[model samples]
Target: MLKARVITAIFLLIGFLAALFLLSPLGWTLLATVVAMLAAWEWGGLMRLVGIQRIAVALLLGVPCTTLMLAQPEALGLSGSLDKGAALSLAWWFLLPALGFWTLLVPLWLVRRFPLSGTAFGLLTGAVVLLPTWLALVLLRHLGPWALLGIMALVWIADIAAYFTGRAFGRRKLAPQISPGKTWEGAYGAVAGVLIYGLAVYFLSGSALALPLLLLIPTLLVLTAVSIIGDLFESLLKRQAGIKDSSQLLPGHGGILDRIDSLTSTLPLVTLLWLVL
Candidate 1:
């Protein structure tokens, strides 16, 4: 598993660098949309929306949504004067439904006992899990490569820190019901790692720090917490479905969704922060 993970990481790093430095920003946007669409496909399966209808629905819903999100600055709102920051903020704010839906699913999971049995319920749940994340990716990509890289770095740092911390010292389970392996210690590590990473990026980019390091630290910490929630949220979904990982797309990482769960939650918040403050 570790070897596979290393291999996958190498490939992902190569791809990301290529996209960031070699490809046009437009190309990055296109690639991001494609990834979003693929995630939507995986989401359809998780939702129990299988067969041709599932594909059709996912494409119909995911494609236009991804396109509009990516094109939001120019195509959807405020015409030419549309603020990228504002648009990202709005997207994050709009993700409330997805968050609410996930919260609601907790009770359902506890009550239904066999929650994943119903196709309709699964489809709705899947939509809640899938759409926001896809939209977040679109918004991040649209924010330009720097913003996208920043978002990605946060997720990556969180995951890496969480893994090492949890392995080194993980006595208390953070969410044993959802993901037994996750630990509070690891969660804290994730927060710390991401905040430090955010600070590094902020300084390295030579961007003016409108806010103090203290303020930025807390913001990144909050974003890291949100990212963990996103991972646990998806883990809960998979647990109820009697599945492990979102898909077998990656040799060790599971699927795109598995790799991106943190980003799914963090990106929107980052986008919102970038715009609002």
Candidate 2:
């Protein structure tokens, strides 16, 4: 299992890097759309929408992404027509609600253990979970592949730290019913890891995007918490749906959603910060 995971990680890293640096803006949008499509399919599986229902859900979410890209490439930083202000304004239409969903609704949903049922609600929830993420992927990459990479690395650093720290010193479960493995110790480790990573980037790059240590530390802490919520939310849904992984699409990695679950929650907020700050 470890070997399979390592190999898959290598290939995924290579492919992602190639796409990140090489793909045209439209190409990146298409690729992100494909990812969103597959994630939507897996999400449908979680919703117990089998066969045609799953495909329809995939199309329902995926097609509009492409349509929006084609109609308003400038809004995504794909082509230059609209100014940055206008483009950012358009992004808020999707991302503002996404911000609300992640920061407010998601925490409550997790605490209350709300049922993810009803076709209308399911679709709406999926849209809320997905579309901003798709937009974030495009906008962030456009902002600069390295910048996007650094933010993503923060999540990876946190997850890795949490995993090992949990194994070493975990005493209290973070969410025993939803995910048996996670613990509060792991959560603390995650925060510490991101703090170190944030500090390193701040002192090293000295970039304008690197908020001051005061602002940066708080933002990283909030993002770390938000990332955990995203992971747990998906875990809760899979448990409710009676599945282990979202899908077996990525060999040892499970699926795209499994890989990008944290990204789904973090990227939109990062993009919002990028625009506003």
TM, every model: 0.79, 0.97
TM-score of 2: 0.97
Candidates' RMSD to native: 4.0, 1.3
Off by over 4 Å in 2: none
lDDT accuracy of residue 142 in candidate 2: 67
Q: Which pairs of residues collide in candidate 1? A: none
Quote the lDDT for 47 in model 2.
Answer: 91
* Cα error of candidate 2 at position 12, Å: 0.8
> What value of lDDT does candidate 1 attain over all alpha carbons?
0.67
Q: Write the per-residue lDDT of candidate 1 for residues 1-277, one digit (tens) a residue.
A: 9999999989988987787767554455567667776776677666656678557655755655655646564522324444565565556545666555434544355334344556566655555555666556555554556667766877888989998999998889988877899999999889778777777877987542245666877777767776777788678767776679777878888878888877776665555455566
The lDDT for every candidate, in the order shown, is 0.67, 0.88
